[model samples]
Target: MVQNPARRTALADAAIEVLAREGARGLTFRAVDVQAGVPKGTASNYFSNRDHLLDQTARYIHERLTPDPVMIAELLRAPRDRDLVKALVRDIFRRISEDRAGYVALLELRLEATRRPELRARLTEAVRDELDANVAYHLGQGLPGDRETVVVLYLAMTGLILEQLTLPEVLGTDGLTALIDAIVERIVPAA
Candidate 1:
């Protein structure tokens, strides 16, 4: 079907909102229909099933969460300075803070991935691609290790994000900044 960009964007936003507010259990055609202000069966017409809806929602969240081109270019071009890394880390934390609901939806998707192998594979590949990109950028700055280091750091960042999401005040801006500083100090210390 030829979908209007505005309509598709609205439906996608509504899906994310529903998934965030209600988790996987709360996601339904009716709820999305209400959220999107579309008639019943509209969402189903676009997304044949709940799995399809969730998959698209996951993809949307991933795109929203992934680092942007400007940041990627900065990371690629900038020197291996500890301050630069810290700044990047702080920006990352800020973005996560701004999109708490999306992060929560992603967490729900991660759990669901475990039970569904196909979803799990997709999730794994997505994570791996992200890590590879970051690893390549860091390597460009003369960081050590190969794919393994990138994977480990990616996992570590995920853990940090989860902690921030669960305990935002505890991992407040200052605390998270300090944590990132420490990580940068360890990984890319000043000369």
Candidate 2:
């Protein structure tokens, strides 16, 4: 079968929605096909099996959530300081909140990885690469924090994003922005 990157991506994006709305157990080819509004068996036509479909879903989430280039350029032009740190982190969290479905799917993917070593390795590499890329981006922009700080900040923010997305009541209502500020203040601080 001929490869159609666009179609494949559409299916994977739909799978992300399914993974978020229904979770790991709800992620099925038929669900994806239905969510994507494609004919039955369309997902199978592109993906060999569930693993392939899920791997593609992870890729889709990564691509979808990457920091926007235009926004990055704007950040680069700004002075390197804690204010910039807050701006970058706030922007990231804003995007995360906006794409709650994709992030929820990612959470589900993380849970699924524990039972599937292949997925574990794949997600681990992807997250590591993302961290490295983030560190590079910060350095290129002369932003605060070294690679080590960025790694720690990433881990911290991961937990925050999880709670903020899934169990907001745990963190309380309408205070995530302040939480992000506190996290940045402790981790990166005023440059």
Candidate 3:
């Protein structure tokens, strides 16, 4: 259906809230409407079905995230070294910890993808594109090595993020910063 960008964004954001709080099964059209404080059929008008709503929610969350340009610029001004990598990692983890539900929604999408092959392929492609863009971002900064190094760093940071989000206490109160520093030192080769 044709909807204004603002209206669609609002509906998708509301749908994300529903997905985060109630999981995929509970993300009904009425639920999104209620969450958005719009009329009962508003979300239905914007989205043809639950799949449309869910896809929009996933995309909305991704659109709203991605490291801030200003933050990236500021980081770029700093020396390209281990500390810089730590700063970037810390920025990522900080954002993740702040928007826990958004990450939860993404994780839920991953789980739901297992049962939906089309969604799995779509999400895998989307994630791969993002990863490639990330590699380019790293190389553009004149960071050492190739995409493979960045990919390895991505995996390590992902594990740390998973642990931090799911079990912060497991990191032993050293917190995101210290853990971030450790990973940057260990995984990121000196440039």
> Clash number for every model?
0, 0, 0
Candidate 2: worst 10 consecutive residues by lDDT? 171-180
Off by over 4 Å in 3: none
TM-scores, all models, native as reference: 0.84, 0.94, 0.93
For residues 25-119, what per-residue lDDT tens digits would candidate 1 score against the true structure? 88898999999999888888777778888788888887777777787677656655556666777777778778888888888888888888888
Cα lDDT computed for each candidate against the true fold: 0.76, 0.88, 0.81
Query: Considering TM-score, where higher is better, how would the candidates rank from best to worst?
Result: 2, 3, 1
lDDT of 3 at 22: 85
Q: Which pairs clash in the backbone of model 2?
A: none
Q: Which one is best on TM-score? A: 2
Best by lDDT: 2
Tens-place lDDT digits, model 2, residues 1-191: 53998898888889999999998988999999999999999999999989988888898899898889899779767789887888888999988988999899999999999999999999999988888888998788777778888888889998988888988889885777788888889999567
Clashing residue pairs, candidate 1? none
| For model 1, the run of ten residues with the poorest summed lDDT | 144-153
